[model samples]
Target chain A: MNLAFTEIQETIRMVQMESLDIRTVTMGISLRDCIDSDFDSMNNKVYEKITSYAGQLRPVAEQVEKEYGIPIINKRISITPVAELLGHASKDQAVQLAKTLDKAARDLGVDFIGGYSALVHKGITKGDQTLLEALPEALSVTERVCASVSVATTRTGINMDAVKQMGEIIKEASELTKDANGIACAKLVVFCNPVEDNPFMAGAFHGTGEGEAVINVGVSGPGVVLNALKRHSDADLGEISEVIKRTVFKITRAGEMIGRVVAERLSLPFGIMDLSLAPTNAMNDSVAEILEEIGLERVGTHGTIAALALMNDAVKKGGAMASSYVGGLSGAFIPVSEDNGMIKGIEDGALSLSKLEAMTCVCSVGLDMIALTGDASASSLSGLIADEMAIGMINKKTTAVRVIPVPGKSEGEMVEFGGLLGRAPVMGVNPFSSEKLINRGGRIPAPLQALIN
Target chain B: MEQKRAVVSVVGKDQIGIIAKVTTCLSENKMNVLDISQTILQDFFTMMMIVDVSEAEDLAKLHDDLDKVSQELGLKIDIQLEDIFQTMHRI
Candidate 1:
């Protein structure tokens, strides 16, 4: 046989038993040209552009899945940040644009449509202000529209004003959807050093620099990595890193192949392959379990950071070797609600909010999908964002905050968001007030590393 | 002409008429089996077949046909493009 029997079985086992699959095949359609002076005209253009470019995204992805026999979990679309298209529009118009995007996603049968976003890391323009003001309404009314705001960058520093406003916006968004356990908050994220080519949602947006349209794919295989580690349980740390790298390399290669084929079928350009080990709420498909298999009793213990760092580093090393172009936030994702082990870690009292904050320093994204008490002050939320932004600014890595404060839910209670968003235990926040720091509304100066030129 | 190949795998308890049923369906669909290997691991029969699907009319229909055969034989059968295995296991 051209392929050994074991090789064939290995691929089958990865998909059938270990849950190896592509998380998303996101089509990035640039909408910079969809802007118009009239709000209705602009909305129509946006709708037409997205539907035309992505109308076949779902069917084509399904065809490829059948042919290749690799399950593709999501087919999504990300567009140019809506703030850029809102120059001639108002706050109401921003929400209207979100409605337009929602319709396009529904008509096309895509899972979610991202890029209802604003990039205000440096300062908020009139357009950015309108989008921020409309976020709560826009998110509350839409079923499939996801939004993100980038408030800090290493070169631009932290926008304290935007950070403060986002804290209020998060609270309002949660309150508006209070009946659904603050589900709206699950579709909104606040980012620092946000990537433009991310294929994963609530944060993916087609960058201004991208072409008219491109296809980016995100590969997820936490289960495959965990199973491989279990096979080499007796191996030392160096050997463990090697095992992770090899597994990542194989999965990344598969992702690249799928992405290129999908691009060819759509007659679009093949963009980067995001090699993120995004975990789901399924058993054996967890990043925390991989860390535990690496010798931690739980995910939030003292050695968790070191284990995560090694895994993140090895993923990049192997993924780089496998793909010619790999971008987005590529590392282990630690969303507390989405991964079974993380939920268990929180329930077992080993994972705390502060511990999660520290882990984000080494992982891919920041305090993702965490639930806070209803009484958590907006100032405390701003304080949490500020702290995570500082880590991203100083470390020059992409970080984000997507915390939900469930209305009428207190600490130690569970709020179910259901589906891929999963349920999270409401964790307590520090009682100490951050009002003093959050009240000072100005930008934090750029970090010393920003002068790399 | 270069042949487009796919892998057809079957796993179940060893039983009579399993191979005959699968090969009959492939010939009916104009798909030729290039090579095959079967083994009994942990008391379950496993078989891997590389088949030339280039001349086949419809891959989806063939998949459906094999699915029906699997149900009748009480086995799990899967057919996938060989490119997936080549891309993953081979550099």
Candidate 2:
């Protein structure tokens, strides 16, 4: 394989100088076959299957990192939604299963294990309700377990009942881990139109449609893209889009190659390469900075949405051109805490909760990693989620809410969740109450556009 | 047959004996250097080498050995499999 000198140098600079990394290599393992009538037996089978499939994940990822000289940031596992395997299990059994998952993740030396999830887009089944009941305890008691609830989709519309329930669930999860600054909420995501093969955490799950086992890779290069844009600082929007598309093409190609190699080594089918410009707590590694580099003085100021739309479209265009199997939330992420520029924007008073919500209309994920006031009511949370869900449901895109109501923390106070989760300022919510609207708990019927089929 | 290749890159302040030490380490590890290039740009040294490591028994050990040279020479060193470069830069 002949290569150009400039290409080699650029690759080296991207990895060494910039924080170019394969964010995650997640193995999605189906737990449908692990189900048994007896909860204890089912728990053991789930553990065994997960450990057997993911035991090699960490070592293999580390080996690849060494050989490739690119950082493979995380090795994770996403199982089939535990609710599907629960059948008629009790809340206690659900918590036990979550413990089992946490233990399996620890034993395998992985960072996080997702899919303590339920898909109740239309309505909740008995099993789904049971899992929801156990979510707060499951997430609080376990270290590595992450959970998500899908409450809306384009085809099924918004499940307002489930939305209301998730609001209370988020509050309970936060209060259960209040001493840790509501960190449990960081692991729980409420989604509309969630992807099955997403390797990113807080929302990743092995959907029912996936095979027995598969490997999905997420590549992150916000810093690399920011550096690329710095070179074209004086260029117009059209020229800037070209630079971004070219950069994303290279990044997605690298992700596909690495995903194929990792899958081959594990003897698992390669699923997809999620070319999301996932940011981190590190300086300069921010999606918000990419927006700022695209002519915004600040991330949430005027022209922010236009800039985000351009970036999101160009990323998908370039990523789709690079790999045939481009899936997951392959767009720009604007999570509040995970992005340094966003944190700065909030601190500088240039960003606000409303502005963040508006920005979600253009970005990949919606209202992520934000911290709300402790006094914010569950009704308000549901209202916020409903608005975000409507955006996704109407547009046929994936949107999620992972906001934390930090207990006893008011607006202007900071909740520090160290490491990749980062810290968030407790942004003020709308003082106006939405309790009446949220209490009208019923399904918002599928939109007119959903009748396309 | 799959081509067994690796990219070894070095960068730092211009220093003497950097390439000599790097190639000597590669040769000792049973890696055949297929191509090598280096340049001094504005008082900084940069070099890239493509090596065939088919006979090398342990890539991890080779990487560690190169790390030792990097530490001693006060340079940034990276050794990656060739497929990463090819896949990202080429069609």
Candidate 3:
């Protein structure tokens, strides 16, 4: 037979029975040329460039989806960090540029436009400060603009000053959008060692080193992995890892193919395929469920981290074998709100903030899509970020924090951000203050790992 | 020129004329069925057809026509380009 019947059936089962999908086709457009001292002209250029480049993104993605019969969930755009273009601009100008980005995203029919961002790991420049100051207001005012701030890296250690300010900025962002349960904070991410070409938001952005325009794809298949593991339920961990690796290889291959098609249609350069098992709120599509299927009683139990480490490593190994360009946080994503199983784990008293933090040490992204008490102190938030950042710094891996302090909501209360963003139960934060430690406001010097060079 | 191939998958409860109706739609759309397989597992019908759609004027229209037949027969149908299956499942 030219095509094996079983193979065709298996592919159909993966897409139809399981919820395998291409999570996003993100176009990263460089806005470095949009820079101007005149904020208005710069904003116009940014909008024009994004609209021109990404105008056909949705139609092309839809056509590809129809042709391939694979669900392409989101068509998004990421740009050069807005801060880089705000060198001589004021805080108000930064906010205006953010609005321009929001308008561009809407015009292009994309779900989100990231890169309202600043990389302040070493120290904050004047432009970085302005962007940081405008983050809370910009996020609150815009619907589709996503923001990220890089506050730590392996080469240059954590910037405690920016970390401290980020705590306040997060609080302000939450309070400003308190009526909607601080949904704005859900669109913001704080990262240590942010990748240059992540296709996922709220961390996607075209980095300084990327080309003029590039198309990156993110593939999601926690359900596919879970289904694969189910077939080998009695297998040992080594064999289980093998199953995961094989499954990831297939998923990554599909993503790379779709990415090539999309980039070719758009006449842009293909960047990378991010092979992440990103879960949705849909049932049976949870990373936590995959962990549970690996013989854990629940997601946050004793063997959870080890199981996640196995899966993450196996995914990367398989993805590396499948695609030459595997960038972004290419492993299992454990976003609390976005995964139904994680929410169940939290509701069952099996998962806690500390436990999730520990799991982040082994997973792709860190402390993502978690919600905190409305009254959680800024010091505690900063301390939590500092801890996650330290893990990334010491281990030299990417880690991020996207905790939303949903105003007027207490621990165990539900805060719904509607479709895709999902609903998160406000998890409790440490009551004690870390003000003294956070207020030190100096760079946490690079760890010994930095000496590898 | 090489024929443009597609996979037409139909799934539903087992019933008579499932294959006949699907092939009629494909023929009306000027698609030639290259390979076909059907199975009945405990009264559930599942079939896969590798069809050459090069002569079909509009692939999307053919898809919609097949979908309309699938709905009338109370079945789920999907028409996917062959490349998706080959690229993903093959090395």
Candidate 4:
């Protein structure tokens, strides 16, 4: 046999038992050519372009899954930012475009379609202002249209005006969808230094620099890494990192192969493969569980950041070598609601909002899928977003906030958004005021490059 | 014709006609078995076969036929292209 029996069995065990699977295969379609001065004409062009480009995305992904025997969890589409297409368009026109996108998603049978976005890190343009104004209505009215806004970058510092507006927008989105536990907020992300080719949502978007269309893959398997760590329980931290690297290398190889084949079948250029360890509500498949397997009593205890820093670096090192093109937020994700172990950590009081903030400084994206009390002030939300943005700006990494303030829900209460969005316990926020700081609506100066400390 | 191969794996209890039933289905579908290995590990039977299905008329139907045989024999049978294993294990 060309392959050893043990090697074959190891692959089987990883898939059948450890919840190893390709997280998503997202097709990035460029809608720049769909723009027109007339709003309805632009909406029709956008709809036709996306539907035509991604018509075979689901069927092709399913065929590849069958051939490879690996489960591809999601087949999604992302497009150019809607702000780019909203030339002299009204807020109602922005909402109309979102509805068009939602209809396309339903017709194509994709669960979520991202890139209803605006980029205003330095200053908001007229189109961006219109899109931001339409966010609450557009998000609440659509079923599968995901939206995002970039309010900060390493070079641009933080746009305090956009940040403050997004806080109010999130609140209105949740309030409008109170019947569904604020599901509208679950589909919105506020970002700082967001990536261009991210295949994960509600953060994924096709950057302006990308080609006409491309296929990007996100590989997930925290459960596989957890099992590998358990098998080498007695190893030192250095040895433990080696174990993680090797396991990540194998999984990345599998993911790249699947992605390339999918792209080849569609006759589109293959984009980057995201080497992120995204967790789900499944038991033993949690990134927090991987931390616990690394000898943490719990995920948010002291020394958690150190352990996470080590693990995140090792994952990048391994995945970088495995795939030629790697992009997206390719780090360990610790969404509070998405990972079952994280939910347990929150319930047991082992994890707090503050600790999660600290952990994001050393890991992947920031404050993902968190739930806050209904009465949490918009200024506080803006403050939380600013703090996260500062970290990403200073460190030159991508970070984002996707929080849901479930209306009429208090701290310690739970709300369910179901399936992938998962359920979250409404946690209390700091009861201080950031109204004065948010009221000073000007750009925070970009940091200096000479600071070594 | 280009050569395309698949890995067919069967895992279950050691039972009568396990090999006979599996190979018969492959032959009926014109899939040639290039290499095979079977072992009893901890009182359970595990089998791995590398098959060339490039000449098969309908691959999906062959998969369905093998699925039926697996159900009758009370085992788990999965067929995946050999490229998946080669991509992971080799490079």
Q: What DockQ do you compute for every candidate structure?
A: 0.87, 0.87, 0.81, 0.82
User: What do the candidate models score in CA lDDT, each in turn?
Assistant: 0.94, 0.93, 0.92, 0.92
Q: Under CAPRI classification, how is model 4 graded?
A: high
Docking class of 2: high
Judging by lDDT against the true structure, name the best candidate. 1
Give the i-RMS of model 2 in Å. 0.7
Give the alpha carbon lDDT tens digit for every residue of A162-229 in model 4: 99999999999999999998899989999999999999999888999999999999999999999999
Looking at model 2, residue A240 earns an lDDT score of 91
**What's the C-alpha lDDT at position A418 in model 4?**
88
Residue ranges of candidate 3 with Cα displaced over 4 Å: none
Per-residue error (Å), model 3, residue B18: 2.1
The clash number for model 1 is 0
lDDT of 3 by residue, A424-443 (tens): 98898998889999998899
Looking at model 1, the pairs that clash are: none
Error of 3 at B89 (Å): 2.0
lDDT of 1 by residue, A1-453 (tens): 389999999998899899999999999999988888888988899999999899889999998998888999999999999999999687888888899899999999999999999999999998999999999999999999999999999999999999999999999999999999888999999999999999998899999889999999999999999999999989999999999999999999999999999999999999999999999988899999999999999989989999999999999999999998999988888998998899999999999999999999999988899999988889999999999999999999999999999999988898888999888999988999999999999999999999999
> Which sections of candidate 1 miss by over 4 Å?
none
**Per-model C-alpha RMSD:** 0.9, 1.0, 1.0, 1.6
Model 4, residue A21: distance off in Å is 0.8
Q: What docking grade applies to model 1?
A: high
Give the chain B TM-score for each candidate. 0.97, 0.93, 0.93, 0.95
For each candidate, what TM-score against the reference?
0.99, 0.99, 0.98, 0.98
